[model samples]
Target: MGEDYNPEKEDVYLMYYDVNNLYGWAMAQYLPYGGFEWADAKDYLTLPEDSEYGYILEVDLEYPESLHDSHKDLPLCPSTPAHRARNSAKTPDHAEDQT
Candidate 1:
């Protein structure tokens, strides 16, 4: 594993190994935001080869906030008074004279 792993550019791998045998291993990649892309036991090695199994995990991840401002350009919902009130609060009133 390298420290240079960048979440934006690559996926992180989580490996499972049989501690007794040391040869038996399985791997999976972590999905963005949450969860993982798991590999089948047959894809790497059989789990029954050793009853004791352990995990070796490596992660490189990123979480970025949305750049779009939700408050900007919200369409007024005519059905809801609360929504109208919220939208009106955000609007600048020209009738109020600025000091």
Candidate 2:
């Protein structure tokens, strides 16, 4: 029988493929500050790829093979502090300081 291949159910595992000998590395977007976000490779390679803008990956840090936190060396998603600041608007603290 031929090898079973299902794209939908299949998760493209990219690790140690020697694209650059960078172990557990992945492509992600880097925010202005200092953080990273992970993107699905399969989703990336889909028919309608998101190539409009140059979405880069965090190749410098190590990425875990599985989604689970098994390796400390591997890097995770960026923290939420930066995210909060982006969407939030605050008034001047001088008003509160006066009272």
Local distance difference test, each candidate: 0.44, 0.53
Error of 1 at 28 (Å): 25
lDDT of 2 at 73: 36
For model 1, the run of ten residues with the poorest summed lDDT: 69-78
RMSD of 2: 16.4
Candidate 1 residue lDDT tens string, 1-99: 589867677454465644673334333332245344564444234435343443333445443335223322433321346778776663245446443
The clash tally of candidate 2 reads 3
Model 1 lDDT at residue 1: 52
* Candidate number of the best TM-score: 2
Which residue pairs overlap in candidate 1's backbone?
A: none
